[model samples]
Target: MASALIMTGPLWFFTPIQVATTVIAGMNCGASTLQSPLTWPLLQDEAIPAQYSGKQTEWLLHGSEIIFPPFNGVCTVANLVMAAYCYYKRNDGLATSAIASAKLPYTALAFALHVATTVYTLTIMAPYNQKLKVASRKINASVEKGEEKSSATQQEGIREFRDAQAVWKARNYGRGAVMLAAAVANAVALKVSAGL
Candidate 1:
């Protein structure tokens, strides 16, 4: 019993980090997923208080904005820890692992998933975020102070702007899917690559 416990002792340190990594990935997925069911349509498309759509729009982005930056930071650390084991093997120590021989492949997959999501955020989503910011400013300006309705001339622009927001929302769902893939990858890594 003592010898067996000693043999598997390396697992103690790694298990928590792997679990944390998986959980963070899940939160990353949920951040984008939450917006899909309600925020875009009710708050953005047909805002209850149209002038207040600016506030609603900002609210929609707030939770994701909080999570998005730090998520990459955590993912970077997790990848490095996993990659270290992959590159520097401790054969016999963890040779019992199914993923021991697949060291490079598992680590490579984890890295790829993280990078893909980051690229999607920086390239695909950043532009839409900027556009939404600019449009929100324009929207606020269009609604004159104390006015219940916007200028009729600006209605067309607002319509187009809302359509843009809808497009952005749809695109965000794709990012959520990518994040989910990352979560699953990390979970598999957590399970099979523990001894790599």
Candidate 2:
């Protein structure tokens, strides 16, 4: 003789909110980013030499310009939708404390992080991007004219541009870290939704 177990609910129990939350959170954590600025440095350092930096940087930067705005916008919208879903489920236990003295508003945290990234792009990256554009153009123009670095000023300008690019590269690590945190936050949100 064998015993059989009977289940009360359907085989699948995911509601619409839960499904949507899972989808968006899955995207945040598992998907690749739309931005490729980080990879440009590899090309700049290894494949492309300093002499070709102007043209390639200009090309890559323009490509980034075309892609990132809408991509980041979509990210913001996704975060908004996530926050809304989390909000609607607040009464379902999401609003409760996650740990001692700490409330786990995971979706809210994710949304704030994305907003901060946007603000950073606007305030910090924008000016630095402008500097890069100008430097690339100037270098290209000079190279095109076959002007060998004859003066201290020209050399200094090149050094400045190189330094600026280095700083931009370093800064992107911070950006990557922030976005990683956002993804982790969204992952937590997904976990919370499971219990609901």
Give the per-residue lDDT digits (tens) of candidate 1, residues 1-196: 5334323654444556667878888887886777777667776656365547755676666656777768866875676677676566535556434344454455557667888888898888877777776666666666754433556635654675677678888898888888888888777866664434
What would the C-alpha RMSD of candidate 2 be, to one decimal place?
A: 6.8
TM-score, model 2 to reference: 0.68
Per-candidate clashes, comma-separated: 0, 0
lDDT of each: 0.68, 0.56
RMSD per model, one decimal: 3.7, 6.8
lDDT tens per residue, model 2, 1-196: 0111101112122234334443544454333232336455564573454447756666766776676556555656766765665455445543232220121366568778777767876776667677777777666666667777664445655666677677766666566566677666655654554443
Candidate no. 1 TM-score: 0.80
Q: Which stretches of candidate 1 lie over 4 Å from their true place?
A: 1-7, 45-47, 90-100, 145-153, 193-196
| TM, every model | 0.80, 0.68
